[model samples]
Target chain A: MRPSKLVPLAAATLVAALAAFPLSVARADDAGDHADARPAAHAVHDLWVTVQQLAGGDSAAQHPARPAPQAVPAGGPTVNLSDLSHPPDIDAKLHAIARLPAGAVRLTVPNGQARLGDYSIGSEQTSTGDLLVLHGNADVFGTLRGNLVAYDGDVTVHSGGVVTGDVLAIGGLVHDQGEVDGEVRTLSAATPARTAAPPLSAGALVARNAAGVVGVVLTLLALGFGLVLFGRPSLEIVSDTVSHSFARAFVTGLIGQILLLPTFGMLVVGLVLSVAGILLLPFAVAVYALLVVVGVVGGALAVAYAMGETYTRRRLARGAMGSPNGYRYLVVGLAGPVAIWLAWALFGWVPIAGDLIRGAAILVTWLIATAGFGAALLSRAGARESFAGRIIPPEALTDEYLWATPQFGVPAVRRPGKR
Target chain B: MSGSRRARGGRRGGRRGAVALLLLLPAAATLHAQTMMDASASRQLHGESRLDARIDYAAGTLRVAPADAATLYRLQLRYDRDRYLPLARYSAADGRVALGVETTGGPGLRVSSREHLAQEATVALSSRVDLALDITLGATEGELELGGLRLRSLSLRNGASRTSIRFSRPNGARCSRASFSTGAAELEVTGLGNSRCAEVALDGGVGRVTLDFSGDAAGDTRARLDMTLGELVLRVPRGMGLRLTSDRLLASLETAGLTRRGGAFVSPGYERAMHHLDVSLSSTLGGVSVEWIR
Candidate 1:
């Protein structure tokens, strides 16, 4: 058969086998119960005694209580007399013996074979039928027409031994040296004796978590640096909004988040009602995702910048030596948030405290994001807008000219040395 | 009769009437608590050409039909205010419109022991646009008439609802795939041949299902039906060549006017028919019957 066809057949067989496993186990349990309820039968006991005697180098004549053969009925089926104690059908008898529970039977085949640690079939001898061994080793040096099977014991066929049928070892091993006309199969014994590996050390686990946190922090820093370089203006506006009107921006952002779903719903409704609207849905979804991302990054930057501004202002008032430049602002803004996040990640391993700190960080980050989004909206997407809704008069630009506006085409002449 | 006897009888009647009045108060209060809610929305098609639509509903009677050509889709809803109403969203961009309706209460809302809310939606698909449709239902009765529409793909899912979907006319475009899955629902799809899809799949749990393949076949089609503990009935047109294979455990199969060949059942003259259909059924704990129709 082709491999493809064989695969499904093998799978089906496996499924059937698994389905029957529980039933077979239950049957084995019942048989065990029955065995416990009764003493060993005399015939079986005598068979074991004969095996033991043979194993001890006793001659067959020493055991006179060997099982007697039963007479065959006239004109009945022909019975093999070589082993009168066994059934006429040698194959059937061997199968039945094999089906018995482990250790239930100790078999010495040929009725009088020499019981070395291993039984051997001589090279000069040719067996007409299959050889069956139970809980014992079998060594074959001669030819046989039928299979050689061992249960819970190994089977070895040395050089010059030829078998026309299969060689099988159940819960055992096979060592084949001679030519076999059929397949050789062995089933390994069940395994439950292996030990499991020990758990990792506490230090190793902590190191792993720390590595994960470092990786995340590095990635975030790279992204923050990119935002600072390319999106400076928008970032500045959001940070300014957070510094000036943090509470109002936060409330607006919260409201916007709450209404986001409803607005998307409305958009979908419009799309369904208008076939032409379908073309715009994808763009709208993309824009929405972009907005959220920008809001979050801007909010984080704003928080960082606000902190930097406060610290710089305090230091400058105290006559400290530090340049307050764009680069300093960017570095402080980026590092502040990253440090907070890293702290959150580290404390996350501290049982209850870790959970509380992580939750607080998440809440604070969300608020910052909303506040930044509100700020972005208030700034009209980074466009400059006058609070008074009017341009300042040129006269107002000159000192001591607040009351008198500067006239066009003429420079304002300050009063000569009013000091 | 004496005057005192008459007076005592009147008093006893009055006491019984007062007791009856008190018993009816709670029922009256419940009736007063129910409120009627109405909502409707519509939008016009401008430049978009394709639509992706999803309708999610729970615990209501829903009806869907093709709309007249003036708009892309229109929805009309009437429900009890005490219960959740469906929220609708429509967005169009990049030549694709996504329209969806979900219950405001979402899946967490517990269905109250009251009358089922009534909700009806009439959607008109523009012949100019191709569509992908998805519907999810929870314990809601649904009727869908989806025919004469340009469809790309369609999917329907339901839980403990009786839903019937029909295609009264052939689809304008060839559909890629159509599928339905339900839990303990009596689902019937008529004119499946009109769906003009290369593949159709149905999965049902503990409910009766009828799939009628009676519409004109746009091309050769394959169908897969899987059920756990439910009866399935299939109707196939006699003129079409059919090959049916069933994998069943603890279940039986009955075929009418079909010959069992190898592991599959085939209709007579299947080899010579112009159009062919392949059906696969996997069912447990129920019977499948296939009947040929002209």
Candidate 2:
């Protein structure tokens, strides 16, 4: 390739890659942002804890003999230090304690002690049981026979310091320069664990399901009416194709479904190999998806029209008195699937029976949709009417031919006695 | 007159039905919900001389590093509670531990996306103990820093991930072998010399790979790399004796500083260099390029 060709090719390749980059890496970017936010949150939490501790200390000094009250939280005011295994539970406990009103707050640590501010253990000192340190770093210069937990603070195990149990620092880091006979952990800024939403009641579930079904039916009805108003001729052709060549339409739809992925793969590979056509890859993909959606949806609606037309003509043949039009045919055809779906929507809360009904509804809908899709393909999206049973042979085209087709509700004429 | 009134009544009913449908659409959309939670678990070192650690993470970001001398193993996780369960099972009898996340009957074959970020895990293993580590990743971005740890043997199975295994410092113990099997991933192994392994093997499937051999080498190393597709970039120290034998059918080799010697490629001072490296590569469709690192 010449330089002139190469430059544009390079530019196109760059543009294509840039355009495709977000689809592949958008999630990664969001993940990175979340990771970055965590550290910032930790810093903010530390600052808040520091200010609160300072304010609390001054207030404690003012009331020399006053005993601080316990702060009530979901995990209760007391944090049991016996088991330091589940960190989130401990975090929840401490998170509540940390949010206590700024003044001195008392925490009950069973079999251990709680410190309000920065705390330290001397080289000669030995503390037993689990120790809870709040709003400050815990410097361990001596042996701690129990677990050490620092909430909104750091924990440092210096040389010669020995911790017999686990050391955990919430919203902080663990700087271990000494031996810990147990595990060490550092948890990032605390966020409450979100549990799955409560299951809906049977009545509520039915209501939701019914609403979903109604929304879908109404949307389809609206689309069907538009098709009737704007594209009745093509729609009728496709609908007639479905009624006349249901079997052929169904087989074609099945083959189309099976070939969808392979066909897409081939198209992509062909475009990519063509090099210059790579610039049109994204547009090609979008167009392919749009075509598939149109085929399936439009075909399904056409099937409904065929169904409604069949039903209405039969009723009219029986001398039923009612005005007939494309709109009524669409409405009548749509009612078939809607009725099945409504059955599911109303009784879907009935466990086994509901699931069975839903499955059947899906199967029937797919059956009709496949037939519709096949009809659309056979009729060339209503552009060709070969399979629509509307073709009249040149020799058979007489004044009686129009009357012979009673689908339009015109009464059929009798043949001559001589014939 | 009655017929006309019936038509008006039907129109009014149609208008009411449209309004009802508009109200139903919003209620239909409130059915989706997800939950994320955090959990941590660890085990203390108790005179254990060796350990077999297995990590199985399905998705998200993973980090594995050497823990403090006092702890045997530790894992911190933030995961989708509805989709996965935190795994931290330890068998004291066999000196083995399983750490990471496991599926809780959730959808299988989850691809990397924004939801993956919510499931993260950090695993730390003791540097004091001899370790045989096995890791499996799916749709993950991982960093496994194995340096400064006593590694006996290593095996990693990567699935559709971007991962880097780095030996930032010299291994504390001699490793028998390190094997990696990748599936459609971008994998990089840096400071291969520091890994202190007698043999390194990589089986790659359709992804780019970079192998950097730069550090203090104790002895001659043997590396076997097999790539089905994608590029492989090799970085070796300038003063190393490098001999490469390749079985490539549709792959290109770029040996800028190496001479072809009887169907094999060899560095200038292959016979007398301080450190020796022998590489046998098999590639079907891709390109392999060698770079000399100082």
Candidate 3:
């Protein structure tokens, strides 16, 4: 590869690696002493001190550009910038600064003897307010009473310069030669750290996806539990219906779904046409919704229960456990369906496989829900003895033989014995 | 009884039946020959400044957007000609335009699945003129984008369809009232604040309904929502004050960042807020979820 192409490739690889394994890199760096650590710590400490001075109202003045007497101890406030830079206070201050008006001049370093360009702050200036240099360089040769901010630029303080406040360089370098007081900070121009938008770490992504999956699983489990608790018998009937006539129930459910909207519309129109029907519209709608929910929930429960029963019986045949009850069946049924859904959610992190799995899960769930709903409807919401009543023949109406009854044919012949 | 007289009566009846069958054959053939076709219609604004328009469509993908500067309204339709055709009429006298694409044949006409019609209508209004709109749809997917329009009043009704109505831009004039009614349809309306309406009403049945109040409104507004059988989701802007009154039966409600007062959910600092939304919700058998967004 050409040198030019290799550079870009290397950069890309580095970025990808950082994004893929940010925690590993951080841990490795922390395990060993790094040259950049000391400087970073020093800068943080200085910035904290500046924030404290400004927050304490020690540097408040009407004319921010006016020079003030330095209040420095023998070693210049022995404040560890680290100790003063509290995360909460820093966040609050940043938020306050962000809320300031766009055109408001928060700080200014005076144009002194040396005429510096628009992008540079002069050296002889004594700025009492927060000095902001936009896409420029701040060459501080004099005293800076307030915080110095160089955005997308460089800040250089000569040996003769003295800054009582914090020094911040965003996307630039901070060459501190003589900073008597306050914290000093520098952010690399290559990174957009000042924007506070870092690529999402892989760990975070995995954690988020995992949390989402867990939440969905818990919700489904709760729903299943509720179904079993409130409508156990109905759920079992629906399950039996599905087990006995899966294909029939599925086809009926599909048809019912297709016709649901149209039927509802017709009913609504009818109600609107009739004066008395209008009054019952709300009640009718409520009943319709209740029926739909029952059908869907009942159908799903039935599928789960059937799966559970089969598994349980298989285990029993293998001499695994005691006789199974409704609760056991419910657990088995819910577990199978929920497991499928959980797999779908967990594998969603994978590109193609996740989508395929999700699609399959949705298709299966819809089929089961629809079929269950149809089965429930067929059973008259579990009021009927069986959902397969249409296919099953009714039992004989009478136990006595018709021919035998007639054999007593002439009532007189039968009565002879009685007489 | 007379055999000859009975035979004569039967012959006469047979003749009448044959005549009736012969009469229907031609009509049936004509109906059967009606196939799907693409058609379009457009009208330019001549001297009219204001418009009161009504659009009635059934069983098709309906799309509505702003028209070009020169045209007032343009309609593009792809439908089974035998089943339906587009009809448009404009009256300059009262500044009223009625547009409808309706079924031509009687009910139960066999329309192949592939022959489902698609209708798109684009309408332009004079910035200087006020407007009133009424729309009705049936068993169709409908999208209406009404923005940067000087609307006076609006009403929409739909049946067994999925619809989305949006206003990306604020209204040029304040609307007195706006209403929407649907049956067994999934409906979403975004940027209600842009409607600049004093009063809004929504009536829904069977399917999901979403009302997004996420935009800068000129003043406070009131909305009344009535639903049955399905869920209702309300997206409210964080800064906008909200007060809600609900009448529910066998339905669950999930409210975020709201305090209950006198049987109503009210946002924090409701009394002092500059802009407020007062909502009255009535539902049966469905759930309601309210989300506050910035």
Candidate 4:
């Protein structure tokens, strides 16, 4: 291979290797996150009672014929030991038990036994069901016919120790020197239970949706006021175009939306192929996206203006007392779409009715936005008036013609042929 | 430069930096938005012998290594609990274990970004038992180290994933075969000679693949490679004899150090070498490159 090509190839290989290395060993922080969360501490009592019994020591003499596993004291907690899965639930239960006083820390393991402090079972001894050990390590040298769960302690299955079921050590590790027929799980820290909150009530849902609708309307109103303040002429032209050529604008907007992605992709590919244009690729993409957003949003606002103006004009014609102004027109125009959304928000939690209203609102909003976008395109972002029905005849501008024409309201029809 | 020109340049640079930061802020928010759950599970080795292990991972980074002889299998997983649940099930009756992550619902279309599904799982398998291992991956980056394991057979299937399988040390048992099937994935297998497999098969569709046979070998082996598109690179041990037979359509081969013998390429001293690697390759619209390594 050529040296020049080799340099780039080697660099590429290095980059790839560097990128893969992190993905392979990037969980250092995760370990810290889990390790820092310590489970609640359980009071320690009757420590290593099982070990003493196993050795036939003083504690064993007190229980001559294997006395029934009793609580350390009265009114203690009881834990179910049938299933060892779902660590978070078990952690919560254990934490609740841990909070009890030392004398009241007795535990009831359903279908099994619960022991506090260090526990053990010697070889030749066989136990049944599950065993829960808290605040101490579990040393097993015998046969356990069921699961073994150790909380805040280690589990050592010594030689000849046989467990017929799963073993779990929470907040500790498992030292396996013996045989286990089931799964062994060691949790360094008991993760908190999943916080998937319950569903909200219908009233709460309605209130939330209403808040969202109000926020959206407020934002749109601010944008419309700014447009009226700075570029009323452009807004007026676009509004007029939407009123005069609504269907044409809608068709153009639909086509533009369909071709948006393909056009962007083509622009990108063309730039890459033309190496010099690659430098301008990012700027070009940003500009293109900005233009699209401006057209769509500005057009929607223009449509609202047109709607408000028409309504105000009709009200004025019917002798309703109201100021005819750009701000008033925008406000009136925006109220139409906002009212649809308001209806949706109010009834959106009504099952089928809510969904139907929401769908109608979305459809109406999309129609208006699309027509507005098309009008913006046809009027060249309000720079052109060809689609706004603003063209005038040259004869109308003549001096004699201007003198005869009415300056306000409707142009008085030429007075029958007097002109 | 004039003072005004310098000032304008500095302002432009500052504006660009602000824009870049603004663009990156959302990406940072997205990375921190998802919650990852960490869980680990293992099983102690018992008197039982043979085992069958299956791993199915939908997305993320996966690492598999040989575990201590005392452990049957151990899995440490960090996953997105919202979409997936960790799996650790073992059946002592058939000596079959299934370990990995399963979707919360059934396998639906995954529309999230790779970062959102950034789950990680590390699996360690026992080396004492005769093992049949199978792995299936989707949109994953996997590093499987299968050396020092008593592996009997191996099968890997991946979709749009990058997976590298390495046999750093020789297998404890003779492997019957190793097979790989990929869909638009970049897969690399290193130290294949250490696998001690009699037969190796690879089926690829539209992705770059590298198979490196640069480890100590015990006996002769055969490989059948079929690729539809993209590139394939083969790294051969210098001491091992190589025989390559290819069926190609619009694909190019660079047999730099091998002799073209009739319809196939043969390494030097192929007939006298201690072990031979017989390869039959079929490819379309892809290039195959060969590199001899020590």
Candidate 5:
């Protein structure tokens, strides 16, 4: 958030203060004029500041600024939310949606996941970093991640390139030539003699979030179904096989996806047949559910398998997971997300990955689900002996993979001589 | 069974073959005889005979393993400080070996066991009755406790055997080598203080090998492996200086976190490590993984 934007916001605070306590507003106005009104070097989430002001009312206006403002707590913020778009433009809509106060504020986006159709949207990386959005007029500052879509304001993309999704920051500052993928549009707004552009909204954020959570749950549900059907380690191993074997998973998943279109098409056609063959109509629906249940079951098995291997090696070796009963899948598959979500809820309330933690978890789950589904299709075809059943320990790999480095200096002998 | 009815031109082997046929009840017994012959004498085997020894050695060059067992037995040579020819017709015995290998490491001699173990001990050796040769090596290079020594250049060919090799080191070090073959009988060379072998190979068949080379004494270490079938694994120090190169046939090599010096520069990770190793590893069948740790 820039200093210029803060000036009006500061004045807006004064106006609201004046309306409430008249006497304190007078005193603040006088003090405001006397003091050079230097901008606060550090900015907080704009929405948090807004909610603080709204809740605090007039007395807070005269008081010194909060050392650290806060965003909405876990239960979610209390907003005077309107069912319809209030003020109608992107800027006002964003303001209305976020409801930040007139001054410097901090806005931390929820990293929660959502699911839309077959796609899992939102962060699944259970990290601790939050996407903190500082307040400003046209151009915004602070960390931006995930889908930063539809901002009519000319925002400067920073050096820290956005990893995924679209970038649409219009009017004032596109100074930072950061990466952008999706559509970006710009329009001039007339009224204010300031560099204001038409405001753009992000229904996708809500849609994406909702879609992510749903996707994750559905995927998990599908996995659970498969687990129930195929039995343990076998199911889990297959699911993970797809995930770890990205190429195989993708190819197999594509086949699955391709086959699904026709299955659904057949279902649609089956509905027409059901009208005539009413007795067999029930069988059709049962078959559809059966296919879905079977698919999810298979997917879960694959996920479980991959998760198990990954867990046994990286975690059990270091004593991170300490169960002797061997319920590795139950522990890692189920517990990883919950642990991350709780951490974010507890510690994420501060800074860092708190807000973004949930999002990361969602992303991870989404990937897992995709792999699970692919695995279901693969196993159904009984390709168990298909040149892919080899278990090569990571250390033996010859290619430079994603997280591989000569650990010569990595401190492998942490406790070798202790015993 | 060695036997040959003395026909017209039959020579020394004639009587030897005749004796072999009579002792056919237990072939192993005939192969392992209760007699002593000079390393220079060409003593024909009347029956199966085996030579089990009790020895104490310094670091020298004598490679005894299963991969080359068949080849060595074919050479049947004399035993001692002479031309070390290999062959199947070697002396045999079933007895206990009592010998100790002196420690051969650097100054620290930091015996990691809080202290040192019983520096000397005795172990029994046999070929027909005993299933496998279990060898144990320790941290510091110690003297060769060769209680069971028979073949001049012995090679072990086992169908399926347990060669449980154990090693101890003051420095908590572990190193091993394997070539690209499976079902190659396992041979554990224990008491690392005084042992020397440039290369170790695993040819074919099913086998489990355990090696403990926990010392920096060896000048330059190199392991060559050629596998056509079955599983092979080598666990060593993660930080140990190594040069790995691979020619993949069917098996996928995974070297996730091994510390090595020279080789086709593989981006430090599992895939590259597996690919760049100079092992003749092909997976026409089976799988293999090599782990490094110190």
Candidate 6:
């Protein structure tokens, strides 16, 4: 709080801020390049893949990073670190790993492999099967030799182990507890983007903004339609019930996302199959058609929600009826149809955006539907009290609710608007 | 904020509204309120994934960043061999003119600049200056173009954008290995009659590329085309030994004194067979043809 004393502190703070670049560059020495890429972005697409898996009735949750985490097999890859003294059974069995920097290789199960360069010796890295080795950390354990590239990772060399190429983990941290004769080419770069980069083009800016607006509108409409179909009062009851429970809603949402996405992909596949089957397989086309309808409804619902939020009439009417009843709604009025159609038109023209919208629609549908269910249950009050309550479900959150009761699939009724 | 303004106004609260109403307040005019910092043109080299480079003296160095990642291009000119000066920073974020090479380096360097319509980083120079351009184009549609400059190495990463670069100035000097993979972009050397190189391999994603020899090759050249799904076209001069291979290759383009031996085209330069050859080819999928021109 001392005004004069703040000078040193200010100077120190500035120094610290300026030091970020150099420190980051130095710290990047050990950090995982792949790790920095992050798996969050993949979640959306992979979840859709999982949805496809789930809709086809296949076990998609089994795969990691999907909405529904698939249960890993009982006999998963065993990593007994205590027994890490010996080389993994190369021919015995090892998990198929690929593009692993040139020194991080251990075998235990059956897998495939591709190695570039030579990490053990100079010029290039050797290769082996199942386990792909990159020469970031150039140390070979046991007796392994093959073509693996020693790019930028460190290497670990066991006493009896040997490699064939140069371990070029130049800027990366190199543990010299190994042996290699190949030269190291040090590639140094100046400070990278210290701040967030500006958008390269105006169109990209417009595109991102548009996507956000469209997504928000879609999310709101889903809630509105749910209210309209189930009736206002019931939706209120369910919504309140769900608001009381945080744990239940999170888990249910996670599970639902896992189940719904891939359904569209499978529908596409089914459509393809139906085309192949011609008129003989009417069921495929019918199923595909059903999915299309749901997609259309979901998108229309989103547009309607955007409209209702932006428009005064619907916002006021919905407010009187309460939030839960608002969601039990659908597209209405000329403006509603036009907005919805415009969205559809944009999506149709851009295939990439269209696919993205399809996925977004599915996600939005699930989000609002559950939220709707929670709202209805909340207004009704203990609508699912009959069911055994281990804990509160998604329909009973303190802030927002989705279910009229604790059970997952149950939908609640709507209520009438206030005078 | 409104409440605080009212409190400050005390007896003359009405005046506060007038104060707020004024545009560009006298007091505020002097105050430097916080605002967004300007985005200085920055091209930090994201270490390349693939290194396939060569060296030959041409005009200026063509610095390329060939990935979807926002890449800032730079120029490192040195007073001596070990130093450099910063030129400019550019990014291939827009599918519209992301990179353009101005033909205004130290004279005798005829730099014809053209920024293509694609999200890739590239700078094409067609001059006669003995300058070295270090390029770092990524593997995501990341491409680098060199018409008359010397290169060191061409690097690439896994699943990166395809890279295709053609080394021209066919008769000037020769280069070493030009390795490409993942991303699809290439260097199509043309107008170079009898030019040659050490080794060339077009890996997967190292897509539809061509190393055209307009007239002829310089010395004995060695080239290999490795493609998973794209195309590769090589133009051989008038007469020379030709060698080409793949899962399937079509010799629709004619090459004199070239006979099929095994699955490879045998055009032995025998030495320096990449001079004075006009080879124009389009592969439907993945096709490769290597021939030695006169």
Candidate 1 vs candidate 6: the TM-score winner is 1
The chain A TM-scores for the candidates, taken one by one, are: 0.45, 0.55, 0.45, 0.54, 0.34, 0.21
Tens digit per residue, CA lDDT, model 4, A339-419? 999999999888899899999999999998899999999999999998897886455465565567645653545533336
TM-score of 6: 0.28
Where does candidate 6 stray beyond 4 Å?
A: A1-336, A339-419, B1-145, B150-159, B162-168, B183-195, B205-216, B229-241, B247-294
The local distance difference test score of each candidate is 0.64, 0.81, 0.66, 0.82, 0.39, 0.37
Interface RMSD of structure candidate 2 (Å): 4.2
TM-score of chain B of each: 0.85, 0.90, 0.84, 0.86, 0.38, 0.42
Cα displacement (Å) at residue A161, model 6: 57
How much DockQ does model 3 earn? Answer: 0.01
Over A323-364, each residue of candidate 6 has an lDDT whose tens digit, in order, gives 432543334422444454346445534558766665665565
What tens digits encode model 1's per-residue C-alpha lDDT throughout A1-419?
Answer: 89999888766655665555455334433422122222224224334434444344433334343222111122212223233111113434445644544434344444222111224455666766656555456656667677666544567776777776666654456676776655454433223323666765656655765687678656656665666677667656666766777777778777877888898789788886898676466566678778777765656665566667767778889999998855566566556555656666566667788778778867766766677767666665545432112345544364655337545655445533333
Global lDDT of model 4: 0.82
Q: Model 1: per-residue lDDT, tens digit, B66-103?
A: 76664566555554545554344555444433332354
- What is model 6's C-alpha RMSD? 27.7
What DockQ was computed for model 6? 0.02
Scanning candidate 5 chain B in windows of ten residues, the lowest lDDT window is B35-44
Candidate ranking (lDDT, best to worst):
4, 2, 3, 1, 5, 6
lDDT of 3: 0.66
Best by lDDT: 4
TM-scores, all candidates, are 0.38, 0.49, 0.43, 0.53, 0.22, 0.28
**Per-candidate clash tally:** 30, 0, 8, 1, 152, 197
Candidate 6 lDDT for residue B145 = 41
Where in model 4 is the C-alpha error above 4 Å? A1-110, A115-126, A133-143, A151-162, A170-172, A177-179, A187-419, B1-35, B106-117
Each candidate: RMSD: 28.8, 20.1, 27.1, 22.1, 41.9, 27.7
* Candidate 5, position A65, lDDT: 32
Per residue, candidate 2 scores C-alpha lDDT tens digits across A96-195 of 7677653546667777777655566666667788888777667777789999998766788878789998888877678778778766766664265457
lDDT of 3 by residue, A1-419 (tens): 78999787667655654454444334424432221332333334334433433334322222243222111112211212222222122223333432333333232223211111112223444556555554334656667776665544567776767777666554456676765355454432122113656755655655776677678656656776787788777666777777777777888788889989998899888998997687578778779888777677767777777778878989999999677876677677667656666776567657798789878878878877887777776667666655543343323312243334544445533433333
lDDT of 6: 0.37
